[model samples]
Target: MEKDILEVERKHLSNVIKECDEKHLLEVEDKFKLTYTYDAVGMGENRIPYEDVKRLSQSKALLEYSEREQKEILNHLKAYEFVKNEAKSTKVFDEEKLKDIHEILVEGIFQGGCYRNVNINIFGAAHQPPDHIKVYDRMAKFFRNLEQFKGNPLEKATYAHASIAKIHPFVDANGRLAKLVLNYFLIKEDFLPISIPLESRETYIAKLEKFKIEKDLTPLTNFFKDLLIKRYEEVLKELDI
Candidate 1:
């Protein structure tokens, strides 16, 4: 059943791209601006208004603000921009690439990409994150495991998303960066990027927590499958399919 849905989605996406010329393809990319905003809100506590986000994304330096709300919007926009550019790459995922994406995510806010040097706690969970000192080695093990992972594209990307969050390598922005990497893998495999909506934030976090506690990936993978299906359905609807 899932395979059937995936085949339909694959054809829908192919048709959309086939239907568009160069100019319309560029417009399609622009359509993701609203997507980025929703994704940012999904990962953030202080939500930016939709209009402000649309305006903020337009200005590189023409508009500036010192407020936390504005800063969150700007930072997320930067991270999404990195995702957009990286989606164009054919590069394989690695630690260096992870750091580069983290740098883009937290630029001007803090020195990012470097693994956390201090201990931290996850709210609402008792499982202690590995010592910051072990992050490098742990991350090495992660990529090694990824190389050994034998699964479909959605499974791999979903596992990547779960593992990155579990590792919590960076000082901050782990969630956002992990999701971006998730989409990176998905897009690289020609799958539509899946954005977990803000409305599902609680369930999303709970799914991650379930993975952390049970060491079972089924729940997380299932969550991702639903999101992926929803994402494909949205695009197919836009095409009036």
Candidate 2:
């Protein structure tokens, strides 16, 4: 019943998108892209104001943000641009592209685009990541499984995000990387990008923990579906369609 309701909402959103003015749709999409950047960055615990993010987006001038915050926001914006462009092109999911995205995200902050050399913990989470030594082989198998995934785009994307989080491939920025990859997959599949809001931080983390601990994806998948529906409704409201 839930899946059927989501399918109905998806079809309605699709029809609305198709009927909306292209220029207006593009404008709304651009706005949502910035929102996604802000929300995604916030999720990483960089609590910069949305206005600051907007200003930074328009000009590179350093706002009141500290140097560290500025760099983080800039890199996130760059990652957003990179993912958007690649999704529109012939690019498909590959390990290299994933590394490239990570590199863009953490360019000046830390060593980017390379796997961690030491095992890590999720702080307070129930799922501990695999040993660093196993990352390569684990990620290889992950890619193989991803390639063989037979579910719809939404399911595949949820799996990708959860799997990456479980693998915890990088030393830092794992959550941000997973979210960006989620958007990448969604955009590649001709869906709008989602911004997990800062207000939903606890719930978002809880859903991820559910996946990490119980190997159940239904909670996170449903969470993402709700986000998509909200985005579609926002676009429709903005366009008065």
Candidate 3:
């Protein structure tokens, strides 16, 4: 029943988007980029303020933020830019593209685009990531299944997000990378990107862990679908539809 309701809402939103003029669509896109960028970065450990995110997004400098905060915010902005500009043109979803996003998000902080050579653990998570040696092979299969996945865009996007979290392909920024990959799939499929607010971090992590440990995607899929519906509602309100 809820799934049916989401399907109805999704179609209604899709139709509205189709009727939206170029300027209106651009306005919605711009708002989503700024808002989602702020939310995504805020979900991380650094927790940059919304004002700082706005300033940095516009290329304005803020002296109050530490070097790490400044770099993290800028990296998120750059990564979001990559998604906005390149998602549509991306013909294939593969390791290269995934690594590209990770690289942008960790340019100054870490070895961008490189897999971890040492094994790692997710703090407080019930699921331990695969061994470092298995990351490459697991990631290869992950990409293969992602490309061949026959589920609807929402399901596929959730899978893309959760699988990355499960595999923990990189040493850092895995959560952000997973969310970015989720948006990349959604945007490529002509869906609006969904943002998980910092407030929802606990529930989000729980749902992710459910998927990781139980291999059940229902909870995570429902979580993502609800967020997508909220995004569609926001865009519609912006358009006065």
Candidate 4:
């Protein structure tokens, strides 16, 4: 959360993931074996790769809130220490949890879950979204159907995130919300939280566009899995976990 050059790092995995690659990111960075645990995924940079992760790793479980909300989210995630059963802690994730996650994120800050009736564009350009009625049903199912995904973690995440963005569920914070939802799944596992930078939004959008239109997740999946592998390698040395 501290501002620095490292904090400003950006990633471009939008190739397969519907959301911007760097929109939500886990800050951990380190080197490790290049092996990846996800399925049928390929890795790339300055290119489309790493669609999304479904392992419930901590990195993808975070909600993207303002500074104050970030603190609240951190506190809430940390509060899991009080729970006796680990699996019970995040296994029952639902919309209420999503709301709570968003609530905590915007706890003392503005730009929270409040939706804007006004129309907006994807990447603030052409692809303008239609009215609420057009997007609501799809958006509602987007989160509801996550439990139905029998695919591997990456596949579910890739599907969920890409679908969410495709619907453009929220008016202003679709990307943030999508990232937050993705991270919530990541945390149920144990990976660190990650994000995409705003400056890199262009590349992120370009890649995201491919996923949106073509429905291909290889690029996004590859980007995230490789990052996770790299992060796992780095943190493995530091935390003895």
Candidate 5:
């Protein structure tokens, strides 16, 4: 029974990652704006976005619902809609465009879409920092890398994921947000979005922790490659090839 449960969880995680990556690639490749989804998820309850919650509510597995071309197009539009509204609604990022982008994703309606001063550990389990100021500075630095940093989307995504985990930003929900930011870069690059499956969370955190302290991304890279292959398979199947 334990083996069965583990196997089922693994399968579900792979599918979720595949669907997410493919759909995000669609957004990037087509140049569709999905900043709203980002802002919503990141900014909302400062937790997971509403759409994700809705997705989960609708289906136990968010990625189980495959997106065809038409639905895929609409999905981009939906994400963009939330992004634009959130952008217009607040100044979370202190930059109009970035705010729009973050709002749609991190802070949407279903969760806690638009509030501030909330705090908690967001990565590798939740441990309160010794000094909040030190933690805040680290968080700020991570975002700075996103702005002043240079690299390809995959490079940026990988780096951002590592940095966020290193900083361990947010009082809570950093893991989810880290991936959202990673997806933001991936979608921006027209590449598939990548995520750590729930089943792989432990391994993901272990590897991410190593990257955080030692700045080694080789293990994470291997993990991402596996996710990419799964996404490619999903896309191929959708085309009925």
Candidate 6:
């Protein structure tokens, strides 16, 4: 967290916000919501088309479909909406809040919010996540550390992302849930929400692997900082600022 880098990022972010008036903010907000939903859910093997994603995001009434593709899009849309709403609140990132977020993401994909009871290991991960039985305890330690953690919002959110992913508290949607929570806190702190694009999935996984193995957050912090900068720059371009 170099002072100079943060200062520059903040400057660009402020410009992006100031440049986007109310109408532009609304337009950018819709675009951002759709972009993030697509970026997140498009990582699956049965990826939905961009047009379908945009259409789904614009609808209010939940469309029911037996197809897995339609179901996945709706799940992500619901989860994204939940995160956006939760970001407006001033709640602490506690166990209950974490479970709520997890439930929102995994509502139809799996059992909503329960931690995994069976042991699991990531396929090619550099380090093993905590055992299922130890998941609760590890998360407790994480909450304690977060309470005392003093860092910039990006740093704290990075730590939050890494710690929760390493713990692997839930059986499914752990990564997505962690990302939403990180963005929740980031937006709560007045920083723009970051969407880790599907194109960067490998790099994101690598950074998390490094974190789990070496306890080094430098790579992930840089990753998020760059995303924030990209988001701001994109806003500027969209608004012709």
| CA lDDT, every model vs. true structure | 0.76, 0.87, 0.85, 0.46, 0.49, 0.79
For model 4, state the Cα shift of residue 152 in Å: 0.7
**1-241, model 6: which lDDT tens digit per residue?**
5566545766776776775688888888888887887777665454666677887666733354335566666777777777777778776678888888777776666777788898988887778877888987888899999999998888998999889889888876777777887888788787888889988999998998889889999999999888988887777677765
Candidate 6: global Cα-lDDT? Answer: 0.79
| lDDT, model 5, position 93 | 35
Off by over 4 Å in 3: 1-3, 14-24
Q: What total of clashing residue pairs does each candidate reach?
A: 0, 0, 0, 39, 39, 0
TM-score of each prediction = 0.88, 0.92, 0.91, 0.55, 0.53, 0.88
Q: Write the per-residue lDDT of candidate 2 for residues 7-114, one digit (tens) a residue.
A: 666677788877888999779877887788788888766888888788887887664778778888888888988998998899668999999999998998888999
Error of 5 at 153 (Å): 2.1
Model 6 spans > 4 angstroms off: 1-6, 12-19, 59-68
Using lDDT, give the best candidate's number.
2
lDDT by residue for model 5 over 1-241, one digit each (tens)? 3553323534554465565666555544333233333332333233444455445434534454433322322333454544334434433332334334334333432232222344544433433333455765666665676767676556667887667556544443444445555665555544555435545656776777667666787787667657655655554454331
lDDT of 3 by residue, 82-122 (tens): 97677889468778888999999998787899998889977
Q: How are the candidates ranked when ordered by lDDT, highest leading?
A: 2, 3, 6, 1, 5, 4
How would you encode candidate 1's per-residue C-alpha lDDT over 1-241 as one tens digit per residue? 2556776778877887676666765565666656765565547565556666777667643244446556566676677677767777877788888889788777777898789999888877656678999988989999998989998888888888888888899888888888888888888788877778787888888888888778778888889888887877776666552
> Residue 104 deviation, candidate 2, in Å?
0.7
- Against the correct fold, how does model 5 do in TM-score? 0.53
A best-first ranking of the candidates according to their TM-score comes to: 2, 3, 1, 6, 4, 5
Scored against the true structure, residue 187 in model 2 reaches a CA lDDT of 87
